[model samples]
Target: MKKLNISVIALAISLVFSTGVMAQGMSKKDYKADKEKIATEYKSAKAGCASLSGNANDICVAEAKGKEKVANAELEASYKPTRKTHYQARVAKAEADYTVANERCDDLAGNAKDVCVKEAKAAKTTAKADAKAQMKTSDANATANEKSTAARSEAKTEAADARKDAATDKLNAGYAVAKEKCDTLAGTAKDNCLNQAKRDFGK
Candidate 1:
């Protein structure tokens, strides 16, 4: 689990670097060569997964596939550098993490499994919400750069709204995870757990 966490972190950091470097634009030749390199790396990763068995193998394969998908998405963003591509790249990373997490949850049973899945989903929701909010904020800021004082004020308002919406989304997802945990309890315990979740999340 620790290893996977570290690997995911490393991949995420690489993605951040790729975004900054790739956004500057790349030659067609360089883009094509990078795509080939990504493909080679993916093949190597998948091959490494083949040595494992059962759920472990499944997890390994999922990680390999997730990395490939994320890499491709990042490459596209680097080549295009559009707001849409950047958003897609972020979504890809979120989904990749969720997939691997859900796969890892297969090692558990009962309420624990359920909680694991819920937590993974909550993480995905939080990531996606943040990504969307970032895109919106970026758009607003860019527009603000080209407009008058009123437009700047409007941009600020839009950015604020975007962040508020993201916070709400993350809060809702947290509540869901908390509620899922509550299912493990009975009667009054469950009721108290749910109430706490609602209060904590402002739900």
Candidate 2:
């Protein structure tokens, strides 16, 4: 049953990733419930391992724990749907695979075991690096978008100020033309024309 449980867990995990969007709309409560279910299953799976002994039993226990952890991480990622959480889920799977691979490596001897361990570590390293890179890229894009939004707002404010300044300059130029026309008159007539220009242009 332990072996079968492992198979089912692996299949479910595969399906979760393959389907890609199944976790998106899931509520936090549902995700939490699923988490409890996985934990209970992990305990049951571990209990089944008591029937075995030696490295066989160790491998079984490791697989159970790893699957439980990975499943929880994946579920959490779905619930929160953040870049960091998604990265964590991917990292969890990589670590789980590494643990299982290392346990399996115990079955080998000498150079074979050495090779298996190296391969397992390499796989974990590569997967972790990829996860980190993706998270960094996502973060960078988010930051750039924020900066771009700010820049656009700033540009809009600057443009508005420019238009206001241009309008003031245009009003002043019109007032200057009106004052010149008033200069052509004399006495009370010229004084009245200049007053009107000042009122109209707010000079």
Best by TM-score: 1
What candidate 2 gets wrong by more than 4 Å, as runs, is 1-22, 149-203
Q: Write the per-residue lDDT of candidate 1 for residues 1-203, one digit (tens) a residue.
A: 32223233223423432333354588788788778877887798889988899999998988888887888898888889889899999999999888888888888788778878888887888899999999999999999999999999999999999999999998888888889889999999999999998888887
Q: What is the TM-score of each candidate against the true structure?
A: 0.88, 0.61
Question: What number of backbone clashes does candidate 2 have, counting pairs of residues 3 or more apart or in separate chains?
Answer: 0
lDDT of each: 0.81, 0.67
lDDT of 2 by residue, 1-203 (tens): 12222222222233132232245768767766776777787898899999989889988898788878877787777877899989998898878877877777787665456545655655566566667766765665556557887765665555555455545655655565567557567999989999998999997
Model 2, C-alpha of 91: deviation from truth (Å): 0.9
Error of 1 at 201 (Å): 1.0
Query: Which window of 10 residues has the lowest lDDT sum in candidate 1?
Result: 1-10
lDDT of candidate model 2 versus the reference = 0.67
Task: Measure candidate 1: CA RMSD.
Answer: 3.4
